[model samples]
Target: MAGHTHRQLAVLRAAAAGHVEMTCSREPHLYVDGLACCDPTLGHQLAGLLAPEPAAPRGPGLRVPAVLTAAGQAALAPSAAA
Candidate 1:
């Protein structure tokens, strides 16, 4: 696995703990603890780390909690801790 930036790793950690929230869109937005993440790149990076959640069919503005994939959890492992 490629090394992740500090910010990317932070997002992964938050996602693993279910502390991240995300919007389903072309350019998804991510929030950590109800505060928006200003870094747009984090959202793109998380695309690979997080597994897609089964979203309910609802209105346009739906924000779902984020979940990490196995790879993401691996990235946060002690050896891979960045």
Candidate 2:
């Protein structure tokens, strides 16, 4: 399983339910419906992390699945209750 930051964990929890995005609230926060997407910077970071690494060559990117794969579910499990 991937080691996720607290922010990443929060994002995964929210996103697990559906697509995640920033809100148009006065604070300009991130959210998905009733849930708030915590840590705007990390939210964007996690979004980048979730994207499949660019086509393989000699590069320094962690290979992540295009979608929330089984590994991702495992990563989120430990933090879901919080």
Candidate 3:
């Protein structure tokens, strides 16, 4: 969690729970708990934690299906154990 802040961890946890969504755009955006995250770099920060699903016919800026990666799951483990 060195590189991840509280908000970042929350986003990861939400993603792990399938409560997060992202858009496929030049600058991808992340939405947590059905609400948009104001941070523009949120997608980049969580890139390592996200595994994109198969390519879909989504228009620019449309929602892109994604799943949490092993790293993402691990990221939330410490908190869960606490």
Candidate 4:
């Protein structure tokens, strides 16, 4: 919430808005095509944001789920001071 990049904040906001499904993997990559936007992370960061952890599905494709939590929603909120 304090040090995440603009991209990182956008990723979480997208998830909260149900704009796209996130698939965090070992491979460092991000996706954006039309209305489809994929935010790929190192898995650990997303794990900290969501709960229960993502499943370790077989194969090379990303198969984990990344849903925004309460704190995540707050992160997207505008600061009251601002």
Candidate 5:
């Protein structure tokens, strides 16, 4: 997963918790719908992370969005000071 993707997912997931709506393009690009704001490079990074790994290869090119897993979220919550 790309580092940018991880950051984007982190941002999105954080927003989601606050009931902020988001949208993912057909290409799986994420967007902050109403806000009409997003960092292009960050979006690409996030998309790369979210992409599935190739069936035969391993390593880079494996888009695995570093979306916060439930456990990760729980861990982050306290630090978020929310």
Candidate 6:
């Protein structure tokens, strides 16, 4: 099961709340346009959290595509799940 840490999830959620868009590079690295409020650690954390399982092999380092799921968007909303 792929899972993210609470902090990582929080960053992702926050990003969505701020209307920041995320995308994955060809190298499979997640990038956020309005993530100035979030630190590198938070980004790394989010990447790790949303990363695929080890068996799947998502590439090098802790970088991956930054596409958030519907549940992730919902979680980012302050009025939604925290």
User: Which candidate's lDDT is highest?
Assistant: 1
lDDT-superior candidate, 2 or 5 = 2
Candidate 2 yields a Cα-based lDDT of 0.48
Off-target runs (Cα >4 Å) in candidate 3 are 55-59, 79-82
Give every collision pair in model 1: none
Predicted model with the maximum TM-score? 1
How much is 11 displaced in model 2, in angstroms? 0.3
lDDT of each: 0.76, 0.48, 0.76, 0.50, 0.40, 0.46
TM-score per model over all chains:
0.79, 0.38, 0.73, 0.49, 0.31, 0.32
| Tens digit per residue, CA lDDT, model 3, 1-82 | 6667998887877776778778877667887777888898988878878755556557777886667888887777766555
By TM-score, is 1 or 2 better?
1
Q: How high a TM-score does candidate 6 get?
A: 0.32
Put down candidate 2 lDDT per residue, 8-47, tens digits, no spaces.
7656665666555443222334555545544556534554
Best first by lDDT, ranked: 1, 3, 4, 2, 6, 5
Write the residue-wise lDDT of candidate 6 on 1-63 in tens digits: 135556566556545444343333322334455444345445444543343332433434543
Worst 10 residues of 2 by lDDT: 56-65
* Pairs with steric clashes in candidate 6: 4-49, 13-76
lDDT by residue (tens digit), candidate 4, 1-82: 5666777777776566544344444542333322334443433454455432245453444544456677766666787114
Give the per-residue lDDT digits (tens) of candidate 5, residues 16-42: 354232233333333343353365454
On TM-score, who's better, 1 or 5?
A: 1
Clashing pairs in model 3? Answer: none
